[model samples]
Target: MINENVSIALVHYPAMDKEGKLIVTSFTTMDLHDIARPARAYEVRSFYIVQPIDAQRLVIKRQIDYWLSEEGRAANPTRYEIVQLVRLKYTLEEVVEDIERERGKKPILVGTDARKYHKTIGYAELKREIEDREREFLIVFGTGYGLPPDLMRTFEYILEPVYGAGDWNHLSVRNAVAIILDRLFSKNRC
Candidate 1:
């Protein structure tokens, strides 16, 4: 079984650039639509969009509010429901505080990256841990080239990278979010 207490955080800043320099990344409209829909479908407790910049945070809030408003709901009821699951926070710390407030304790911070750095727990182990321990988790997805090593070091656990037969490992943050959520929460698990 999977845990319904799990949540997600899509980070926008302190990501890596092509040259591996730490930088702030902009959010795409597709990212807002794609990630939130799955988060709701998976029955996640909450979906957080963490942006350090005020303008970018406003953009995310507007998108979430618009999709959750009456007009947007009338246009697309399903998407509206999904957008309601989203929250826009200015920093990861804010997200932590929110989860603590909502769940009465801090969640386990699980970081996700496309590359393997430190020893990462396999998806199966993560799923088992969630089911057996019954603890809330805040799984973070990094944008741009991926989260900086320093940020990765802050996490208690880093999930294994999603890969296929080929050596190539590039995947959009939105797609990665959906894939990871499905693997962690899918009902067909043994």
Candidate 2:
């Protein structure tokens, strides 16, 4: 994919079959399951793109600082190999590119704005980039702040951004997720 906006680290090859369309990098509305596992109250969303994202600055935290992963002594076993924690650290395109080098083959993506990782809605652009893979969506969210504005953009016809409650201007990934699940599973049909 030779997007003029793509990071310089990723080779801009013309070989990519799809281009010119919006490549979403966040979770889709269809991915909202009913928390079937129940082992964890909240599964921090992990962002992924099908195509190679030039996210050299996306600092993907490999450690878990949360109470469960850190201090908790309880048996937090998982049947699906759920990660202990998934954290996000946004930075300049250059920084995200660095992340790409650090996390090879693990899937690195690019960004456009810096909205502080607001919500999954902002991750639309990230999701579109890799929708064809048909993998499950687990968007690791930002801790202190939220995703930046540049990260969020709806996918093309193949997959568009999943919009939930709250306006785009001010929405948290956790809140967006809560709203999404509520609307998706809400039985109240008046």
Candidate 3:
């Protein structure tokens, strides 16, 4: 788990609405705790919440502060410890920049969507690629309607969709994050 080559970014801006129009979604404090917990459990180097709105950032900062406060820590020290991995960023570019600053090179940005993209890679293959390439990666997940093609196109890798027997495959952002992280890092994969 010491690879230190993997990070996750939950993108709120430049995301699409139900009507397919690009918009910036409001930040949700729930997603912060949910995603950060698993990201920490899986030994992810960092978890970035990418939101552009100033007010939203302030709210997120307050929530983060509360989580780190002595009272908050006393309420649930384990939770506070995991949440300490969360970092707030204004945009995906900033996430990349921070990753580069820490790792000494830009991460291989990867996007995740509910639908398969032309050059998408499977979970198993992606696991191998990460190990073989020995490079840092920033796995990006979008909000509504999933990540648009243009935004997805910027990623060096795209993960294949996770589906079940039925046609329905839409999952909440945090749920998808947990599933994707398990697929990428779970040791039981065979």
Top of the candidates by TM-score:
3
Please say which candidate is ahead in TM-score: 1 or 2.
1
The order of the candidates by TM-score, greatest first, is 3, 1, 2
lDDT of 1 at 158: 96
Report the candidate with higher lDDT, 2 versus 3. 3
- Per-model TM-score on C-alpha atoms: 0.94, 0.29, 0.95
CA lDDT of every candidate: 0.87, 0.30, 0.88
Number of clashing residue pairs, candidate 1: 0
Q: Indicate whether candidate 1 or candidate 3 has the larger TM-score.
A: 3
lDDT rank order? 3, 1, 2
Q: Tell me the alpha-carbon RMSD of every candidate.
A: 1.7, 13.4, 1.3
Model 2 whole-model lDDT (C-alpha atoms): 0.30
Error of 3 at 154 (Å): 1.0
Across residues 1-190, which tens digit of lDDT does each residue of candidate 2 receive?
Answer: 1121222111111111134333324322222222212113333233222223334212122122322253332444441233332222332333344434544422333321223232323333443543443322322232223332233332111112344355454343345444433332234523
Candidates 1 and 2 compared: the better one by lDDT is 1
Q: lDDT per residue, candidate 1, 21-73, as tens digits?
A: 99989978898889987888778888898899988878888888888889999
